[model samples]
Target: MVLVWAAASLAPGAEARQSAFDTRASHAVIMDYETGAILFSKNGEEPMPPASMSKLMTALMAFEALEDGRLTLDAELPVSETAWRRGGAASGSSTMFLEVNSRATVEDLLQGIIVQSGNDACIVIAEALGGTEENFSAMMTERARELGLESATFANSTGWPDPEHRISAADLARLAQIIIRDYPQYYSFYAQPVFTYNGIRQFNRNPLIGVMQGADGLKTGRTSEAGFGLTASAVRDGQRRIVVFNGMETERARADEAERLMRAAFTEFELVNLVEAGGGAGQVEVFLGQAETVALRAVEGLSFGVHRRDRAGVRAEIVYDGPLRAPVQAGDSVGRLEVTTPDGRIFSVPVEAAEDVNRQGLLGRAGTGLVRLIRGG
Candidate 1:
């Protein structure tokens, strides 16, 4: 059967206050990882040039290959003339100083891409994995779709300037979340400060990595067309936040804006546990069942992000169709317990049957029908 859910505000006049954050970036988004709630956003959905930030998608492809055994970390991939000329030293882009016709291990190349923002390394991996950079970009676009990145498109392995090579700030944040969630084993490469290849050592370009207390790994991007962009993630006390921004005027602005946004994300809001696992929200009547009623409970704990000052405005309600049919399983869905906070955020948790309800015997069913008819149920 189909169910329709309606939104209800739990607290009136408890709307979240406007965040006092001001950033120089034209597009930005800050999100809480655990709750998937957007803390602050400014033109976050507008697509803009992602520049080297697109390398995150490139890194994601490599990580997936590593996880699935299709590519090993120690596997050596060849550098193509195309990769060398266009993405290497000849192109005047970020390079890992990779030698033409030389081979680099997958692990080192990944470091080159992550730590050094090496456009050459990205092209090499793309060529190795997808037969050519063009094909690899197609793969990247397809993978972005598979991962639910709606506004992301890849024109090249390196986030080179292309009119079509654009991604929204929100999409970048989602990509960052996927990378951190799916590739924990390889995520540390993003945190590495420096990588030395071919007697050249380069530091990670991400501005927040060393300066921010909890900031760890991520990517930075810059091009004349895209200005500057950074996708940064940080964790503290088991909570993580992802921030994405683009179109900054300079590197210093990106760094300061990113840090301010991260700090506000962690400090401005609080996670509220509204209901515990197996906690009963209410009960529902049972029709033609051995028991007259069944208790409804949340299958897991329910939590929400709330403005710290508006804690008392949180409200919860249990909603479901009344008088459930008999032969109910212990975990059968009964209804939904919805909680809403002051900041206009709504969270819903499934409410399930607390225990099984067996169908009544023939006589019991007949009696129940008669009683229901007399009571006009």
Candidate 2:
């Protein structure tokens, strides 16, 4: 039987609900990792200086180089005068405290960049990979475009104050997603609490790690122009959430708001199972076939996140082109099942034929056509 589901209409009593979180940051976004749902957003798309948080992109490039065998964890790269003069202790920015001519392994640099927010480490990687910091920033911008981050523009690898350096909270969240999805092996470095270098141990600057439950790797940012920012991720019950917030007044506020938003994203919403795989959601008429109708089922199980209070407004609809023709086979693509939440997010799953239906014989076709004509079909 072809299952034809009527488009669901919004219930009269259903009302749209707003997020309860009142964030202190100037820009913020909370997203569900599995469903691609935006739990909350405020100025999320507006471009602003990413500050040290831009190092995530720098780290992504290094991870890519490592994966491609262009670099290795134990391989040591020589520190350049430019890296020393511009981003080193003399530059008064975050540094790994490398001597002018000292060599450091790729692993140590990555740890320095991630744990200590070392600007010098970023510059060292930039010089090692692209031969110059300018070239590396340009490469970062090109890679951001390839990654579909339209709002991201890199002026420097360290996220130093530059009028042209900018990225949106949404883009930061997307960047975090790519890092987690693409570089799982290297991502553990982000969670490291401390890295001892040159006999000096510095704790990871990320606020969420260790303080928030299930929180793992990510980065933090701060500059006079960008204020304070954080790109954080956490996993709970097998579900991960990504959050990016910037332009907070202080470190404490950034930490508090980030943790609050992360908790709310996982707690306020629920994963609702809408349709089970291989189960018929509805049926549709079949023309000139052995069976008069055919059932339709989602090719896979369908589920989505819904706000607990707004669950009443959530609706699902099976959408297909038309009444199917004969010779239908099980698993044939038919249409899509769409689930819409009260907040206006739509999640779609493929619909398929539940069973086979052979074409009718000549006489059977004629009889069916005649019956259909009498019924004014």
Candidate 3:
């Protein structure tokens, strides 16, 4: 039973109803998944207790450790008395049902925390990463700021509730965005159905997983004080939509609104191919080098979510200072490719030099100069 919120607004010129999901949440926000651009937001920037959303940051720190090869997924983490006492079945909180003094692998613990909202797993992960929960909370805050999640602080790895442990829906969405974008491999764990530990079956709490198309995985949080909130991301036909809601009236409502927003985004906003990845909108000359000139292409690819009716009105332009000086690397940013609608909303895409161009050496310079002199002397 997904109780969707009333959409209170829509993007300008969009055909769909521009309604904001009427959330009882003290705060709510809707955003473009790909670019972190806000579509509609209310109290989106204010810090509030994140509940289990704090686990998202916990998982992210673990992921960063994994990415840098500082930790391995198969590594075992010892369950401390503090972690076990802080969580588990009798604690009236989420758990992988871990036993005190028993150990679980990093991968399994991650599944527990993300899929099951296991506070036990959160503490275990924090201990494994930073030696103690307090130190880990400090690390989480530092990393949160580094990731641009400035409106957040981590009082505990599990978000068990302290006055200072707070985060905004926008910051929560930002953390989710990084999880999906940077750690593609481990991020898949968020989509799993359940994490079975010590004979207990704990299902993922995210509601949009199976019901919504391309809604693979993300984290969800709920507490009486925090009301009901969710951070959801969905991908459709290569485009992604991310939405976060806090102060929703109910869990089902949060899920329903998430699905509705994603569907609307994919339906109303379509990415038209402007340029192929590593392909040219055009070419440019190199002042001096092994090559006289080289192709310049978008750093990634160029695409835009133009309203279906406005596709024909889209315009693209490459802005550069001038011809590039040689000694350019293959992937050097020389300029920006701007995409604008007839109405003038714009998206700036980066354009990069396609190949390296070495500057002419003294001998090479003299040879070129002598030839020029012979040609025009």
Candidate 4:
């Protein structure tokens, strides 16, 4: 039940399996946030309508606006006639009950968009920043590309029905990661339960929040063609997991499936503490340093999914070809620790130098080389 990943340069998760994403979802994926690992996927890379998950990127743009001094939680904005008319209704269409000619703060619009999924809020924010939805969409596309969302396109502020509009669950997960990672300040707003504006209170529609354990915040979307979807994230026992579910039959099904996957992840995996900053988990010889060698350890914890009975075979091997040369960066990778379980399940974590060792000049290198040669002889 642990999330699987398709490999990537810096991503983490399980390897790909064609049938892994064979849930009720038409397109779906569960991913590990830290490592960009694809845990599970089915048609995960296919470009399908994103419904309101497009709001994730919209939120990112708002966050960027806040950072650059163009927008703020307290800054007020006017809901345009066009935005109000187009969005702010149900039936899977824009509907926040926004009134034309009403003034709403950037924060107000955000809650309406994020919590209520108001189309008006999306357009209002788009116009407030990009001067029009068309321009804002361009910005969204640009930012998506910048954040490695290689499979996303924006046609409108809200993810309504459109043949040309589409996004992948993998891309949605990446979008969620970027917003949370790069815009921590603005992201706190996503967790609020109820947003009150214009004398009305609307509760958050995301089922994961308040119900699922550690489910704090994210966005959801739905359309006849797109189905129900969410880019959900949660942290259980210090490890964070993210999921993107698309084309679900019912709202609750997505929540139930996501919760089950999250539980599986928390229970199956273990986070092992490796080296601390300036602390060594193990030592490797240092050539030409004042000392014979220096120590290395886990940067944080080297936690992974190891079955209970297999813990006996969970042996660690510190790998390095030979003594490391001096002038090494503090966080430089000198080796890797491979952990193998009794069942032959294997995982590898990068091993980094606990501290920097300045390279000794030619004389120092020669001295170490001669010592090594003499020892060999």
Candidate 5:
């Protein structure tokens, strides 16, 4: 027989459901860093121009190189005519002002790319690592797939306009999570406020750095095709969230919307642990066993982001095939717990027997069998 029972109730202090969020951004996603749970999304999966925001991938490649001894921060890389001509001061785009054929250490190039959003720095790194920008971009596309950035594709190291170069807001947020979780040492470079090179200094393009509380590291991108976009992360009271948005009308709108979305991420949503690992899941009837019941426990904890107002609709159910035959061993798979949120998302966690339940002796089994026969057929 199969058995089911309610396992959870409304969270404390939950309020009435509120209206869904509205935003002017054409694409957006907000995620909880710790749980990898998406808090909100609108057109987040659609591929769109990433602009300089894709530099996060370029930076990621460099961080991995440093980790495995393929490259050193102090090692110098050369700037070629292509880098200086196409992406330097003459290009009327972001640059590190590198004189053609000059050299800069990997560390300086990183600061240039991150804090200055220097296109020249990106090209230099691309050439040094992959022998050419075309080859390097191919490498970027390959590595992006390996990193599980499903919507990411690379056509150039600088994220310059290209019909093929595209990434979605959702993938950008996932990439941000990967960097913050795997490369803490290199991730700090994103927080740098300014970079000065060759008698020129430029401020970081990220708009959230100082204006938003707990805002630390991230990148910003803008182009005629991509519009204003940002991929940013913030931490408050030990919780971190990553927000990616694009297609805003203006830089000011991007800034304002980023702050607004991030504020809501921390204030209006929560990571709720509905069921804890090793906790009692439910009780199961035991057949011809020493005990009448066997306790079940969750194999792992279940958690998800829920809107504050929707907490009242959160529900958990324990489901099991009952009357388990003995001898039941501790940790045997018994059933699962199913959770349904207000948004109709269902999450399930496997449950197992919490303790051993041995079979009863022959006499005890006979007596129980006789009682059952007398009560029924």
Candidate 6:
């Protein structure tokens, strides 16, 4: 049976729903890094051209390759003629100014991609890994699926405008989570301020790095079809948030919206620890056990983000089949704890027996049964 414990007194305020946050971007999503809670969303699930912001995927693929020994930082990859002709200075697009037929180390290429947004560097890495850019892009799409990205599709490593190239704002934030959580060592490349290749210097295009406190790594994108877009993450007071947005008319607009959403993400919400790990969740009646009741505990701490204004109430339910029959061992999975926020978001965690509950002897069990019958139980 489910036992609900509504914690209305935790915070003193009337029940209220979170107010909607407005944004100028056509697509946007803000998510808490720790809880993966979506603080705000606007057409976040719809697939749209990501422009160069998709380079996050390219960076992720390379990071994985380095992890599994498929590629090394110092490994040299040849710059093909196609890479130079299509992505080089002659293409009038972002380029690393790579000299055709010259080989560059994986380390330098990554800097080129992350810091310079070099289409040429991305192509070289693609060819080195998949033997061709087209094949590598297919690998990127497949890897995105493997990573559980719901709406990510890739047509090129550089994120050059292609009708088939698409990703959702939600997916972009999720991808950022992966890069930040799973690949911490390489993530610093995104924060590098400047990179020089072939005697020419370029600065990282991400606008938030220096402007926002605790802002670090990320990518920015823009194209005729996909207006200025950004996938950024920032940490403040030990909390991190990821923000993704697209379809702004100008770079300044994208920068403004990104900073605004990030600030609001932190200021407008509060992360509350509802229950501590190993803390008592609730109690459950035990049947034919030496103990009349058994305590329940959460396997892990439970935390949720609630709107600051709506910290009004949080409802939790301790659900289990009871009275549970003994003998119960400590740490046995017995039930689950369901926590609901004022905004109607529910978070669940498994609960377990906090102590042993040995079965009562036959005579004791009989006596208990008689007593229950007398009490009309």
- Better TM-score candidate (4, 6): 6
Once fitted onto the true fold, the runs of candidate 5 whose alpha carbons sit more than 4 angstroms away are 1-7, 11-19, 45-47, 89-92, 280-297, 313-377
Candidate 6: tens digits of C-alpha lDDT, residues 130-180: 999999999999999998997998999988999999999989999999999
Off by over 4 Å in 4: 1-22, 90-92, 268-377
Cα RMSD of all models vs. native, in order, equals 5.6, 5.1, 11.4, 8.6, 4.8, 4.9
lDDT tens digits, residue span 291-362, model 5: 999988989998877777767766666677766888999999988887666554567899999999999999
* Sort by TM-score, top down from the best: 5, 6, 2, 1, 4, 3
Best-matching candidate per TM-score: 5
Tens-digit lDDT track for model 2 on 1-377? Answer: 22324433334334445533457888887778766556666787889999999999999999999999989999999988888888788899988887778899999999999998888899999999899999999999999999999999999999999999999998999899988988899999999999999888999988888998899979999999889989999999899999899988898888888788788878876666667787666666778889988888877777665557766675666677767899999988988887666555667888888899999999999998899899998
Q: Indicate whether candidate 4 or candidate 5 has the larger lDDT.
A: 5
Between prediction 2 and prediction 6, which has the larger lDDT? 6
Better of 2 and 3 by TM-score: 2
The positional error of residue 167 in candidate 5, measured at the CA in angstroms, is: 3.4
lDDT of 3 by residue, 170-209 (tens): 7888888888888899888988877788887877788888
Model 3 poorest 10 in a row by lDDT: 1-10
Question: Could you give candidate 4's per-residue lDDT for residues 1-377 as a string of tens digits?
Answer: 11122112212332222231136778776667786655555677888899998988887888888889988789988888888778865334656678889888887788888888888899999999889998988888888888788888898888877887788987898888877778777777777788877778788878878888788779988888888777788887677877788888787887777676556555644333333344445667776776666667655545443333333334556667667767676788877655443333345666688777787878877887898799992
* Residue 83 displacement in candidate 5 (angstroms): 1.9
What's the CA error at residue 123 for candidate 5, in Å?
1.3
Candidate 3's C-alpha runs over 4 A off are 1-24, 268-377
What local distance difference test score does each model get? Answer: 0.82, 0.84, 0.76, 0.72, 0.87, 0.87
Clashes, model 4: 25
Task: Give the clash count for each candidate.
Answer: 0, 10, 16, 25, 0, 0
Assess the local accuracy of residue 167 in candidate 4 as a C-alpha lDDT between 0 and 100. 85
Count steric clashes of candidate 1.
Answer: 0
Better of 4 and 5 by TM-score: 5
